[model samples]
Target: MTARPLWTSHEAQDATGGALVGPDWNANGVSIDSRSVAEGDLFVALRGPNFDGHAYVADALAKGAVAALVDTLPEFPAHNPSLIKVDETLAGLRALGIARREAVGATVIGLTGSVGKTTTKEMLATAFAALGATHASPGSLNNHWGVPLSLARMPHDVRYGVFEMGMNHAGEIADLTGMVRPHVALITTVAAAHIEFFGSVEAIADAKAEIFQGVEPGGTAVLPLDNPHYARLAAAARAAGVTRHITFGETAGADFLLKGVETGPEGLTVSAVAAGLPLTFHLNFFGKHQAVNALGALAAVHAAGGDIARAAAALEGLQPLKGRGGRRKIALAGGGELTLIDESYNASPAAVAAALGVLGAETPGTGGRRIAIIGDMLELGEQSAALHADLAGPAVANKIDTVHCCGPYAAYLWELLPAAMRGLRAPDSTVLARSLARELRAGDVVMVKGSLGSRMAKVVEVITSLASDGAA
Candidate 1:
């Protein structure tokens, strides 16, 4: 079936308080970037600190956008371009998003957490798809502009909308959540993810709890019963006018509780209960942490009045995400095999520990060793060095045979490791990439993790190139 129109020229004008400058037109989608704009998309020209999107109005039109939202109209070609002229572009774009959300009429689930927001967003989107058409935040589009863009892109006919809200300082999630007004609000878990901006983990949990501010009347708030900040979050939710609450975790009193979970190199089987109904499903991704993430997803689905069993069934095809926990099996030159786990997107002390647990769960091939290549986890504030060194216990406990590390902060971990497990340490990723490439052997299981600033993906690339050949 042909998708319904997202915006009519009159509707766009009324929604954004802009004036239509050309012939009436229709948009099938909404976009901010010209390069990715679809044929019938409404491209919103945005202005930021570094760059101005208004400069690309002509480029967006050339890319086949049905209409463009511009503060200042650009010079057009022979044919006139459909345009919406407003006094300010960014505010106009946000107005359009709020208008879209009010019109879409889909059940919204808004989630926030220190880590796994993106992963859980993806999971919830997939689970909701089991019932009907679903729309979700793209990538990590959980910030100010990203949240608006995701909302503006929501289809009017969608059955469900899943949005991820992220924040560094306080009140950010509250501001973003006010616009979402989700029917079901969830907090994945609170950790010291952006501790640089906050003084304590309690402050972080308080910030995450802000998602409850937008809970619609009669909607439910999903909390993690296992987290230490549960009471604080629950109190905040009730104060925000959220009446119903559902908790998901392995701890007692959780409405959605995990009974047992078995994880393997390929995937994991989850045995749990959602609101007292037994649920047994398999996740395409590995990681014991994912079991909790899965429970959160199921809780959100159930709270949103979706088909829980069908949603669980849809999770069977969910695979490890790229730049998150993507896995690759490369045939070694010596007729053996090596597995690579890429967790090089973002990192924190908790995320690093979880990745180490995943690495430890898998058994290496015969005559092979378990290797971990790591880089710095940034934004740790005054406790950076101690937190970096804290990896010693988790790494050693995970049975990692060797470790290759890089970055200034990560040097603390290198110094803390025993001489037998210390493979190499470099100041940057470039030198470490070469050293790591040279160290890979057949039958090895290697896991790479670091913050985005560390560029650990380069190391994953080097190892991948060597995996196709003999030694690096």
Candidate 2:
């Protein structure tokens, strides 16, 4: 129901047979992944770096796909609707999204950063939903095909749009934002993620600042003031001729300033002043990063001309993304419980620090241990070892009672920890996870974190599996 073709013949003419399909034979939606393709959806068979979606064309068709967009058409069932062969399916999808955005006059908000983009996008979407009809990217579907797919899926009657832009390299954000042509652009904060690719933190800032480049002239720019490179991004926003600028963070200059933060059993309680209005609210998500995400959401909602208090109230039901700092209550073997903070989706130094800060504030069940099970932080380039070693301070500051780590990088932190804190360390996750499973107590507040490549979620799985089996 989210996507409808703007032109049936435009796609048909671009098809191999050229304008053979009727003008009324247009699709109701578009999808790149076959599993998510709904009935009457146009299936785009994109060739990704890993799997080729072309192999799933038959699957899509069988599931009621109206048409197929592909580089090469495969043999289909006799009753199949139509196959549109193009130079590149990915390119075709992009073109359709670009055309759709131009035709529809919806205001688009583009968001990008080293961390928190997805969470912040979700925040913005929830806040906007409280105001009017809203459309947003699902999960971390903020990449190349994901961005266009999100744009193409925009409902015709949506009053506002939020698009999360992401990249692991330079120029990717620029290309994505240009396609989105967002009227409001926000950089959550420039962090040292993908440092391996950019070679320095400044390059990361420059890449994140690319979000401002695609903002329409006289558009608003929302930014963070807590980051050291805030001035650089501020300069970039000014240079882009952004008509309105909004800053969010704990800084005094921030238009929306964090007056107070209270983390608790339910969720995060936040107090802030935005546009000279004092606002107090609670967010459904956990972590200090949620506060930052809320600020970004506030800035976005204010830019969209919504009532900030109403938007703030909407945050109460905003749930966190799975594998992205959401809390899950786990029953222990001894008839008690503890909360699991699943930050297993990805990791970086900045993200780890932020997560630790959240852990530092959480109050677990009576006499419970504050535990951290962390894996490698990948793609640090030359700073990998030192960065790993640097986590000990955060662990101590966060009052983590026990530290169980895996991977070569985590070993650095394991050795650097004081004699009492390090409970387990393994070259790989399997052995370390097995040991960690044995150490869970009835009242332990455990946080699991690691990069995607580190597969640290396996530890969370192992712990949950044991708990499910009543072993811990």
Candidate 3:
């Protein structure tokens, strides 16, 4: 079946106040990056401090872009390229997004937090898709430009739309939420993720609360009852004129309360009560944190007018995203298999602790040793060293047999580890990747994790390449 045209040239011109040149065309999608531009996509030539999309206009057109939205037209080789000339491309993108939101009657849910934003967003997208045609933000498209891009990409006929909004500074989310104007605003939890910018977790909570500022009148606010900042977020929601609230977690007063969790080789079996109804489901993912994220997702689904019981059942097929908690088994060169847990996408103190707890629950293969390869946790402010050192406690509690420390901050953790538990210490992931790959044996459970800047995924790539012929 052919997909419907997302934007016609006439509609785009009306939305952005831009003049069209050469020819009229219908776009099936929108794109900003020339490298990944698809056929029938309307490529927006965005300009930034470091790079300009105008430089790639010809390339984008050659790759089958229907039209290029630009502030300044670039010279093409031989072909006449279709162009929409706006005063500024970024403003043009935002205008298209606002127009799309006004046109669609989909239930919009805006989500944000210090952590679990991406995970919870994926969960919501998965659960909501089971009930209706749902459009969600791809990856971590929750920033200034990412929000508008995701919004503009939303289809006109979608029954539900979920957008993930993120921030490092205080006012970032407020600006985004104003553009989103969601019917349900969800704050996953408040933690010390970007404490370098905010100075304190309370300030982070206040910033996350900004999601409530743009909630449509009579909309709902879904919050985490387990977080210490719950009261602060709830108060801010009420102040923002959002009176309806749905709380989820293990706390006694939570509307979506978790009763118990049992872990098995397959995944986790969760028992909970949502809206006074008993519900039990299985999640093919690790950690108690994931179970909590599931509760929040189900609550948001119910708040958005979907059946909570059916959404809970949809969670049974949920799997961890790559670089999050994804697990893989690699066939070693000689004889056995090695289990690799990839947590290398990004990390904070709280996130690292949760990963460690998941590792603790795993029963390694016969004669297998539990190992952790850790890199630096960034944006921790002045407490960076202490926060890194604090991880040694979780490592010990989990009874990990070996610890490989990478990067300068991880050195603090290396110093605190018991001599018997120490494995390898390197200045960075590049240096650690070589030695760490050789040290692994068939019966080993290895977990790699760090912040994005730490480049820990490189280590995961190297270990994955060790698979023998015909190995999965």
Q: lDDT of all predictions, in order shown?
A: 0.89, 0.83, 0.93
lDDT per residue (tens digit) for residues 1-472 in model 3: 9777899999999999999988999998999999999999999999999999999988899999999999997877688889999999999999999899989999999999888999999999999999999999999999989999998999989999999999999999999999899999999989989999988999999999999999999999999999999999999999999999999999998999999999987889999999889999999888999999999999999899899888888888778898999998999877799899999999999999999888887878888989999999999989899999999999999998999999999999999999999999999999999897678988899999999999999999889988886445
Per-residue lDDT of candidate 2, residues 224-301 (tens digit) = 989899989988888877758898999898998998888777887998898888888998777767887798888988
Q: What is the full ranking by TM-score, best candidate first?
A: 3, 1, 2
Judging by lDDT, tell me the better candidate of 1 and 2: 1
- Candidate 2 lDDT (Cα, whole model)? 0.83
- C-alpha lDDT of residue 278 in model 3: 92
Q: How close is candidate 2 to the true structure, as a TM-score?
A: 0.94
User: Candidate 2: misplaced stretches above 4 Å?
Assistant: 1-24, 77-80, 468-472
lDDT of 2 at 285: 73
Question: Which residues of candidate 3, in runs, are more than 4 Å off?
Answer: 1-3
Clashing pairs in 3: none
Please give each candidate's TM-score. 0.97, 0.94, 0.98
In model 3, where is the ten-residue run with the lowest total lDDT?
Answer: 463-472
